[model samples]
Target: MSKKDSAKATLNDLNGKEWVKATKSWFVVNPKPRSAGQANHPAKYPEELVSRFLRFFTKADAWVLDPFAGVGSTLVAAKELGRNAIGVELNGEYVEIGSRHLEKTKGSGRTYLIMGNAHGTLEHLGEIFKDSIPPFSLLMTSPPYWNMLRKSRGGNDSVQKEREASGFDTYYSDSEEDIGNLDDYAEYIDTIGEIFDRLEPILAKNAYLVIVVQNMRDIDGEMKPIAWDLARRLSKTYALRQEMIWCQDNKRLGCWGYPTTYVSNVHHHHCLILQKR
Candidate 1:
């Protein structure tokens, strides 16, 4: 074999073709049907999404962190991929469900799903992890989109109505600790930045963070550029690397505004990629 082919991959286990394919700026992934426990969470990103990044950013047996791990998607993905994972969730119910999933996960590495606020968990990492915390090579999470879930779109919002009818949570918990519950957009952005800032000590140098977020239209009909805003905010701390667009072609088109306005049915999210500087 040539010297280039014989060389081992340092970033991940992928070969040349796989690595090149993953570098595409945009991709589509129609989520698989969620398990019952997974469906209960309003805003849970798919494990496939997590696995894709995991395969690209880290090699086997690396440590991964998810500050807003809803129902342990990140943990389960990490376990399956042979990576130890630590997830911090604020809701006890979610923690319980996530723990059950983690217990059944058959894999080489360990998984820890802690029930606490993200900031608090970081602050007390030593006590929480029994003083043996691992430096995370990847921090992938889908935080609340600035309380957008809490905003009611009135009678025309069919998705929210269906969630209500099915006894699923329409929004994250009403906990004051959840930054998603904050009313002010500016404050919410700052809190999100602070959480990532707090992760600096534990994140390995050049560790990658994949934050999934979306731009949304507010109730007042103003555009809230959440994805861009967060990128700008966090770039001051972490090195802003690149963004991959996650598109969904399976969602039904909603006629949000009839004849007068041009409200779009958004079916995409921004996966902001950042590196620990």
Candidate 2:
């Protein structure tokens, strides 16, 4: 028998060429323009981004989960790729917008967007699935980047000002239960860790999780390595496979602390890929 005929592709549906291409440690994805309803979400990552990971991580008809579903980007992406998806979102407005978008998504796979905190949402999956919740083969999400959105960058070129002027939300939500609203950084990291740790029961063995996150500069000029911190925290629960850098070349550059101190225009996010043990 020929090697090509005998070799099996187990992780995903990608062929040899596609599999090799996806193995690269970094990728570039500039977000597409958002719709009016989608623009209401302060931190809505693109569906295209989610679609790329979905294609590389899961096969057709595989179940996917997104715990931090903002406007149902992950859910929509999963459906488009013929993968069943379940999303847990906190904000009601975002959930409504996500549901509207999900309705228009045309695909063979089913999708459900539950409006509730991700921390406790998994417990109620039995009520929705009737028999038992399917073990998710892949989990891809970009959770809140701490409370950085609420911190004023103190510049006229700040995107927060433009968002506020355009009547859009500047942060995820004002709810006390929101992870992005937490003030204490250590507690915030711990909470996120706990959330993922709880998913052990629902995740299929060897299921891959791709978390899109980034390091940030605090208002006081302190560098917060959020991406690394999260990787370290989650490593205890899930096997830390590797990190893929998601770079964006389309974002406009801002002179953050120019002429006095060096400040880079960070246009990349860390895609930490982990596997269920």
Candidate 3:
């Protein structure tokens, strides 16, 4: 059933955290600790999002892949729910945290952490699997938004900033490990599309790939429509199914002056879901 068709999602999905929704998105709630972006990476999407995807996309002992594992939220979620998880994180610090969290949380033996870039994973992926890389049942991750300076946006721009300082720039461009340093928007989108296009072969016939992304604010001062465009790009490979809205209740409160009018600060996210044929 569509999110609109169901009664409003109840408080929390088996987990204690309250449900979080974005104004215009689809999917369920996922809550987890923030992964600092500067030292770590900003853990934007909630863990509830991860849990819900796990619930709907895979089953017992299924293999899961998170190409951009950042601090291992997906890995943590996968382990918590009993799925085999393989995570690739660019930052050594994040890999450590993800590793530690999994250890402390009683991770399943199937959980494996790879400290590296998502793109380079192409080479190691085959080796990691050994006897033919098993088709992954589910793939979920949030790609870095453009290399926008997150610190400049904080305090002055947000309702709230989690402990993790990681942002698109911090996660991708700022680090030397980024797959391709294409600053151009179209280039970035195309590169991401290509990455996933290549990823299509490794996924199981009926597997699902879900991405969590929001728009970005540029120096030009206009809202970048990254969300809609990404869907169009990925639609070529995976059947872009729906977008889940992840809204935030807490905020620092601020005003965004309109070039022509007035607008209040906004906080929300889009969780795009895709299923492979």
Candidate 4:
């Protein structure tokens, strides 16, 4: 067979699989507990979760980027999958910790962890990438659930008590620049949207962007539809594609509003998938 025929055959083989398996609206994942290095971050998505998305959206040697790289989970997954990755993290502490994790990953793919605010660092992407920014094939990240961490106070609840005993601060950072510390919900969402807008120029055409977020109750017990609002805002730049619900069934049920009001123990997250238009 000719070389062209071989290439066509390979394409056919890739398309023959049931790619629709990923289209399922929801997934039940039992993520393993965080490793000691990742324990410092209040919120760290499982590397397995990032790996699954990376396999679906990208191929070997393709570029992957994470603007809000908490502990470099995305970068670690990318390297393991043989994809080069760049991560922008705000906290210096997290950058240091995540850098150590990256060094331990045994893979051929390259990884870069930039220690700076995502918003500021985005402007210098080309410089960071050595004079010209490469188009990223995939963007997968989870932002801070706006201000929820700050509101979490140690209580008699076993989970809260355990976290408090561990001496881990509930919030991501004390920095005023941290989006999780923002008190104004509208401003916080707008700020996040703006970051995506800035990223639009750097993203490759038709590339997929996945944002993992969850709705949460505010300090006043009001439900803040963060997931929905962000989707709507980001639709201005990228096409709003489907959403996959990430369900976690392992969490112990907590009686939030016992007999008083209807409050759900939210066990699912909105995995909003967007494509560059």
Candidate 5:
């Protein structure tokens, strides 16, 4: 067979791999407990979860990018799987903590964590990657849940209590530049959209962008469909391929509206899969 035919056959085999075939629309994941450094961040995606997605979406030595690199779980996973990774984070403290975690991991891949707001850091990233800036193979991140952390006070839940004891501010940062601190939902969405818009030029053709997000409830007890809204807006730029629901079965039941009303205990996140058009 010709060299091109041989390559096509290998790609066909990869697409038919067992894990790819088994990937369902919805699945349950019980992530292991976080390490002390990882636990410092209020909202952190587990390394195991990130690893699974990485395996499914990319091969060895592929470049991975995470714009909202909260504690760098994605970078850790990328390193372990032999993928070069670049992460951009707004908080300097988190960049420090994430760099420490990357140092402890055993791997042959390269990981770089940049401390800057993702909205304005594309040029910095281009400088860092220089000739290789336009072809990142995968982008995965979980942005702030839209001011949810800022409203965590006065709750009796163990998780809430633990967060209060962490000494870090309840939300991501006090900087007015942080998107999580924005009270206006529309503005928050627009800002996030703009960030992704700027990121578009950096993504390679057919590369995947996975965003882990959930809808939230406001202080006034109204439902905010953040995941759906993001999907609608970002679909303008990237193709909305599909959603893989990450269901959590380990969360304790909350008495959100015990006797007066009914409220859902949102124990799932939308793993939105978007492919560059």
Candidate 6:
């Protein structure tokens, strides 16, 4: 389809992301999924989603970075789309998994996979990315959703400490670099905002920073309206562009009728697409 037609089609879907433009053999899928749930980084994300963001938000040969590179979905998609990609992942095992895949499939585009604490990236990122550094045109990352999606029955206190623990050797050996273990709601926003704050210098002047987060059900099964809170918090730095809805194909089944206060099974997630101004 033509560029104009493609944009129109993309806007038609009310999902978290949409397909934008295509170049060669591949048709890019936008706004990569949150996590692929691999054994290492059980939540790496889908490549199709990453490709779409690269296609529309950036030009060919542009630079992209995934702060919590999880399992390399972002780098894989960026390389495929003819863009340079750098992934900063905390867990060493995941870095191995993602880097190995990147080396095997690398073509004209290059990828740099770093296994370390991403919070301190500013100190040495330039040296490591000096030869490879380009003004990051796009940043598509999904921070840890406060670890609220856990199946355990522990209180919020326990979840925070456990979330930061490295999941490299265990069954759920996943890392939480995107959003570290901040217990309080206020702390969660502050911690994540600080991470984004560090990335400001590396991003291009007008780069787009897109964040994907789903609201969580509290211990009492109440929906915590985090999207609005996050938007308000981030508005201090980034300009809130558009709040897109990512409707999940699968939502929890069953509901109890409350005559006084009631809502429905929340099927959609909030994709807060913000730009650094």
Q: Which candidate number maximizes TM-score?
A: 2
Q: Provide TM-scores for the models.
A: 0.95, 0.95, 0.78, 0.92, 0.92, 0.72
| Of 3 and 4, the candidate ranking higher by TM-score | 4
Clashing pairs in 2: none
In candidate 1, stretches whose alpha carbon ends up further than 4 angstroms from where it belongs are 1-9, 154-157
Per-residue CA lDDT of model 3 for 23-88, tens digit only, reads 235433434445443244544456666877776667657788888887777887888888888888
1-277 per-residue lDDT for model 1 (tens digits): 7777655437899989999999999999888898788788888887888889999998899999999988999999999999999899999999998899888888887888988899876665777666677889999999999988888874655788889889999988989998889999999999999988888888987899999999989999999999999999999899999999999999878777788888888999999999998
The alpha-carbon RMSD values of the candidates against the true structure, listed in the order shown, are 2.3, 2.1, 6.9, 2.8, 2.2, 7.7
- Cα lDDT tens digits, model 4, 1-277, are 9998887434112343546676678988877987686887888888888887887888788889899998899999888989999999888889899999999988878899987777875665766766678889888999898888777632367465577779875678888889898999999999999889888878877889999999988767788999999999999999998998999899888776667877678889999999999
Instruction: Point out where model 3 deviates above 4 Å.
Output: 1-40, 107-109, 154-173, 179-181, 258-264
Overall lDDT per candidate, in order of appearance: 0.89, 0.89, 0.69, 0.84, 0.84, 0.67
Query: Which 10 consecutive residues of model 4 have the lowest summed lDDT?
Result: 8-17
Count residue pairs with overlapping backbones in model 6.
13
lDDT of 5 by residue, 1-277 (tens): 9998887434112456666654888878887897776677888887877887887777788888999997898999999989889899989989999999899999987999998888876887868867667478789999998898887633477476767776644678898988889999999988899999889988877889999999998878898999999999899899999999998899887777767877788889999999999
| Alpha-carbon shift of residue 107 in model 6 (angstroms) | 4.1
For candidate 4, the TM-score is: 0.92
Give per-residue CA lDDT, model 6, range 1-277, as digits (tens). Answer: 9998886444222234333222122222234334333444544456776665676677777788778777788888888878888877777778888877787675577788887666776655777856556788888877767755453433334332354464432222344543544457788877777778888878987788767677776667766667777888888889988766655444333343446545455555666788989
Over 73-119, each residue of candidate 2 has an lDDT whose tens digit, in order, gives 99999899899999999998999999998898898879999988889
Against the true structure, candidate 2 has what lDDT?
A: 0.89
Pairs in steric clash, model 5: none
4 or 5, greater by TM-score: 5
Q: In model 2, how large is the Cα lDDT of residue 173? A: 85
Of 2 and 3, the candidate ranking higher by TM-score: 2
Residue 60's lDDT in candidate 6: 70
Residue pairs in collision within model 4 = none
Model 4 stretches astray by more than 4 angstroms? 1-15, 153-155
